[model samples]
Target: MTLATVESGFNGEPAVFTAELKPHRSLGPIGFRVLMGLSVAVTLINVVFFLATNALPVAMFFGLDLALLYGAFWLNYRAARAREIVRLSRNQLDIHKVTPAGFVRKSQYNPFWARFDVARHAEFGITDMAVVERARRTTLGKFLGPEERDSFAKAFTAALADIKRRV
Candidate 1:
């Protein structure tokens, strides 16, 4: 029943973890490159459209918005990359995330004997989790990386297994 984080990667004593991304949790580097490229292309498209319409101010506004979003995405991606969360317990798996706007927390509880499950939200996207289950549940990440959802899911599932084995 312990949670331990060492840097971006964490190990739980209740179970004990050797931190690394699991098979299901791994995302190819190419995906991120594509995402970055798409984001820039999208922003450029908006800029071009606005310029063609002769709406300088509107174009600038959109540019700023896109820039901010890009920054957010880049930051999140980096954060995710730098940190690995290893779960080695089944009592409580609490994951806390911080951002400029605020901090978000995602956790899972594993009863002595319970199955783990991940629930998908259509609105949240299939790769991203709306809810993660152990014994009961808690809302997962609010702003988890959409492009990195598959990787997250695999990692989360492994964490759940680690918890189950410990308890």
Candidate 2:
């Protein structure tokens, strides 16, 4: 059940750490479509009943509600496209974040100089993980659940430690 993969780097170098992090979405495209269809069907049926009772205003409100629901799901699906990729080689550590709007942000650090830190709460378990180098700190695994974050932190920490021992 490993979520991260390590591969050989360019020029025959080996990868030290690599992870692809994405937000969990409970509904897939088909499930979302089905849910939306069912909701719209029910809303339309209720609106038809209201119209028969001369509640035209209520029917209009139902339409508005459906529109809003559609917009919300659209935005959610868009955001689900966001992802974070982290890769560490013997020389460098790179973090790339891609947002829903297709904006990309990249950060690089020296593997020997960087430190992996995990912030945790007693009851809630792990909260966040970050890579710190000199004056800069970039958080990782913001989209991961507590348990996932904990697992990532352990594996990442071990990788960093191995690098440190070799250097």
Per-model C-alpha RMSD = 8.4, 4.6
Evaluated at residue 118, the lDDT of candidate 2 is 82
Question: What lDDT score goes with residue 122 in model 2?
Answer: 96
lDDT of prediction 2: 0.82
Which residue window of length 10 is worst by lDDT in model 1? 16-25
Model 1 segments more than 4 A misplaced: 1-90, 99-108, 111-117, 120-137
lDDT of 2 by residue, 11-37 (tens): 255678888889888999899889999
Which has the greatest TM-score?
Answer: 2
Residue pair clashes in candidate 2: none
lDDT of 1 by residue, 16-124 (tens): 3333331122445687678768877987898899999998998898789877876876666555543323343545444443333334343444434434345567775
Report residue 55 deviation for candidate 2 (angstroms).
1.0
Error of 1 at 67 (Å): 13
